[model samples]
Target: MFQVYLIDDEIWALISLEKLIPWKEYGFCICGKSNSAKKAWDDICKNPPDVVITDIRMPGMTGLELLKRLHDSKMKTQVVLVSGFAEFQYAQEAIKHGAFEYLLKQVKREQLKECMIRLFTFLSEQKKKMLETEAYSEKQFWTQMQDQQIKRAAECLFQIEKQEWIGKVCFVASCKKENIVDKKNGKMIQVESFRLFLLGERDENAYGLCIADQEKSSKSEEIKKFLAQVSEQETVWGISRIGDGTQKVSEMIWEAQTALRAAYFSQNQILSYHIKGNGWKKWDELSRAMYYKQNTQVRMQLEALKNEVEVGAVLSDELFSILERIDYEYKKSHGKNLKPQEWIRECDMIHSYPSDKEFFRWLMVFFPVQSEVGSDSAQYIIHLIENQLANAPTLATIGKELGMSQGALTQILKRQTGKNYSELLLEQRMKRAKELLVYTNKTITEIAEETGYTDLFYFSKTFKKNNGISPNEYRKEKRIENEQSTNEK
Candidate 1:
């Protein structure tokens, strides 16, 4: 209910107004009343009300002053000005200051009642729209957050080229709201919500599945009851049989989505997906052997794993375990030099997981060694430098990109990356140059052009200083070594 305050200099008029309106019927309540504008202003400052009905010509901090105060403070309140023809000028100024409705002292009860009703309806509709918009925005935010979290968990569980046990799997659930408008708006149908679960297991490794809890069910029955409730509301769900876990999880999610979509074509309310077998070998077994091989055999097995993930896998304990093991292996291989969390982070990067780099940089500052060598400010400085290096023409160019004075970026880069901007740019240019030398057949001039150096002679000089060898000589040596290895094999 919207609260209302009344202000007037006449005691009889104030009491009359207090008793005139059927406030409760209109979803409003009288919160306070004052004899003068000064008292009303005090009451408002202490306890602001939703609506303020006041006289226009009260002495000492007039109704105009009170209205101005509310406006300056950004208070959300409807103002009603009461005045006679003598104070009509005051009423006009009050309207300019956003008075909701004005009434003369001789105004009738019906006029006051009508004004209050209009105000009530306006506020109610405004509130409903605000609530609906917030609910929609918050839902989208939460869904994106959940999708990102699940994807990260999946990456940690599935290594890029090694299949240790967590095979791919899929889970599907659907939801629908009753009597919602269907396509074309010609008829009413149920709105549906679909959920997919994808996972698997390898050897002794297991990954935990932490789906959002259902509001009206116990933790263990959450997924089951959530699906059941949505189905009862006209939403159908279908889960596919668990498959191999040697492919991208996006494929598995799509497979489960497809299975759920096919429910519309089936007679049964509850359906499960199956691969086309026709007395042939199961795809799961075949994909397991195909994707679970060593890196040397990755190219041969990639297709099978890709197909399994495309069709969705199972949520097995082993799947979670495999991710845990990969995380453990990375930590162990680092010889305790990196934090346990870094293992998960590296896995995320390898799988192209989406992350907030700014947030990640901020988080690293708390690490003991990083705190000593890399302050929070220093990390931002390095990030800015790295970003500018892509097309930096000079130290001034880097500074301009970072919105700093001419030499400002240079000092920060020297402190953070331990080199001036020019040196760092040359270093990165040479690093790319080396990659081209070893991995591609690009010539010295082409590599130089690609590395932002238009002049090949200058590029060669920078490369030699960084690596202590000319670019051509380095490529020649690498070519000979590869040829020798191939011949021996």
Candidate 2:
């Protein structure tokens, strides 16, 4: 949101401007307000806001002087002057010198709104052209140059495939489960310790390429694992082991990719790569199956190769294929592509399966015995909450686990499911409590503990408040209902 700083000599004008517009709806935020222009300058210069509003005839420093001062000081804040009829010509002259626009005294909301729209739109265009966002994947790690002339110069300087980084250990890492906000206005793509590069394959937010100092490669992997554990995201590190200093960049990348491939097969977030010379037999077939959009063929190939490697590789591949088909069909029907990443977070759970059979079972869960396609059934955030419920999961704890703050976590939950953290947690707990009440002989205390509450009295109170009955009464009522239905049948 664009930040706006307000300055006016009259107190009423300041108050009216604050209430004149719902600023946020127009993508503007009122950052600071001052009745004195001289006093406001000291505050504004501390951190220049995107836009400044000032009364043309102020007590000491006039709005025209402030506007010229802003330009002289090299601050890029756009200034809008509020003026009376007498100062109309003066305001227009200030605009020629660089004021954004002049607003008449007693500014109407719609009039002010129209001026802001023009100001914001102009500023946005400038910012966009100046800074473009970047996301990195391993495949295109080396070729992210923006200017075609500069890229051609670099191409002449170094061979694309054979460029050498002799002493660096090239690696690719994944943070699939991390609740990362892919950095925006991204002149600097934030991937924990890794820097950003444009990725040609895989979700860029979930993966990054980093080159470690060869001597500290061992320590790097350990530190990376520790960080991933804290975030509860399985991080795969495909290390292109300490080869001779002459290894070409392409060779190291291939080795690192091979290591990552092996890690995926092991159902690991791919923490470390092991050099493997014996490649899989059906790799070509699996790749082809995925390419041809043959979901069954991909699944069959995966099952055949399931016992040969880790379940992670198969499921990840299977998920890509399924998403490919979904995106393809959606495009055919709706005339647009729903990018594969939309369906990917649902399958990030692929790291959990321990056996080949889990592949079929998991597929059944999503695609099931239905003639038509189902809408998105993946509860990505809810699943994370459910997994940690017994541990007395709080929003802060969950946020920490995902490398996000409590507020960021809340926003994500609200955006995805139209619910807040407390509501979602309450629903999960009550649903679990109900299942226990109807299906198990556990006491209320045991159920309370299982549902993440240690205080039985508090749990009982909450259950009654939400369900309109105490635990025992709910359990007895369910049992009576079951018996009556059975007898009536």
Could you tell me every candidate's TM-score relative to the true structure?
A: 0.36, 0.38
For residues 239-327, what per-residue lDDT tens digits would candidate 2 score against the true structure? 44444345444444445554555455455554344443345557678666655655566667656665544544333344445446545
In candidate 2 the C-alpha lDDT for residue 263 amounts to: 59
Candidate 2 displacement at residue 33 in angstroms = 0.3
lDDT against the true structure, each candidate: 0.54, 0.61
Cα shift from native, residue 428, model 2 (Å): 14
Candidate 2 collision pairs: 136-197, 137-199, 236-269, 236-270, 236-271, 237-270, 264-313, 265-310
Among these predicted structures, which one has the highest TM-score? 2
| Distance from true location, Cα of 247 in model 1, Å | 19
